[model samples]
Target: MRYTITGGAGFIGSHLAKALVSKGHSVDVIDNLSTGSMSNLDDIKNKISFHKTDILDADSLEGIIQNTDGIFHHAALTSVPESFTRQQEYENVNVNGTENIFKIAKKLHVKVVFASSSSVYGDTKTIPTKESHKLDPINPYGITKLNAEQLATKYLQFFDVVGLRYYNVYGDTMPGAGVISKFYYCIQNNMPLEIDGDGKQLRDFVYIDDVVNATISSMEKNTGSCFINVGSGVATSILELANLFLKYSGSASKIIFKQQDKGNVMTSQADILFAKQLLGWKPQTTLEDWIKNLYKS
Candidate 1:
């Protein structure tokens, strides 16, 4: 099947594209290059079609999705803090851009898999969050993701749609998308890993390979407007992560403490039972193992 991945040059999108291409599927990428780099796709540059386009540009996106079988909507302004300051830009790119995808997909009858966020649950006492958990977003980035997810659900009345609420995803070659990425970069550069709020804040950090596998399996089996948490169902504290990164990289660096970030959740753990049931997928890598592997040749 022919696939078009938005933000295909980005971290997760690049991994997904390579996975699909390895399986002998035709792949096309439409990335605005806002955060994505062409070097990410260098390994498979000759295998897939690349288009420099934004999701907000309906005319350009329309042409690309014309003959496409499915789309993985991954493009958006992803930073939580930046979203607070650039509310209008996030709304336009993340929300309106998603709406545009739905519009075009509706016309062409194409299936869509939306990349949503776990932040939509906001500051929760709930240990492991379900897909039906409250949709109260603490930040504008989360709000935009929730909006996009809602659009996918609405469009499901006409076409096939799947929404995956991703937790803190980390992997090799990924940029400073989250704390883990920062940890990797800092460890390599001999910089301190800064922790906010005592570093006890828990997060369900899922490996990228597992996320890509779950995404594909869910997209294939989803028959309705199905949504599920794409996470490891395991929570790790920020302090634990810092120790692990230091251990793996064999680096001796102090962890600095800072004021807690506003609009940030204290804890997040995903109830991935739905993913297991729906996609028959489970995360294979543990935090320690992934970190160890990351530093290996």
Candidate 2:
């Protein structure tokens, strides 16, 4: 099977592409290099077809949609504060870009699995937000993701679609791709790990490997219009996560607390019961284990 992963050179997308390739599937990537790096795909540079195109460009995207079997749509502007600063850019990339993919998928009879975010649930009133939970995104980035989910649903009336509400995905793909990686890097270098507010903010941090596995399961097994939360169903506070990283890295650098981010979500987690039932997938990494392996090499 031939698979096209938009943002394929990104942290999660790059890892997913390699996984698909390892499974004997032909993989192609479309990336704008906005935040995705060519270096992330250094090992498989010669093994796969790569297109330097943006999903926002419909004509460019349409040219490549005809040849792929399924599409993993992962391209978007993903920064929370950045989205707040540049609302229109987020609207263009997350909302309009998604529409373009769905439009081309509908036209080409292609199956699509979108990389949605847990941020769409905002600071959920529930500890572990289920797919049935209310979506009250507080930040513009989350709002755009929620809008993309809606657009996907609207398009599903005409196309086969699955959306995975990925939790805080972190792993070995890129050094600075996620907050965990960044914090670890800082700790290793004896630099202060910046903590926003009191470090009480919580998240359902999932490993990239698990996220990719669940994403593939969603693509292969899920039918009709489906949305599932892909997470560990575990919540860890920011301070606890930092401590774990420090323990793993064995760094002596002290954490520095800073002023709280105004628009940041205080807490967010995922309820993956539906995913377990439908995709038969659960997170395979624990915080302690992942952190230990993170600093091994």
List the global CA lDDT of all models: 0.89, 0.87
What TM-score against the true fold does each predicted structure earn? Answer: 0.96, 0.96
When superposed on Cα atoms, how far off is each prediction in RMSD?
Answer: 1.3, 1.4
Model 1, 19-54: lDDT tens digits are 999988899999999899999999999999999999
Tens-place lDDT digits, model 2, residues 209-267: 89999988878884678888988899999999889888878888898999987668988
What TM-score does candidate 2 reach?
A: 0.96
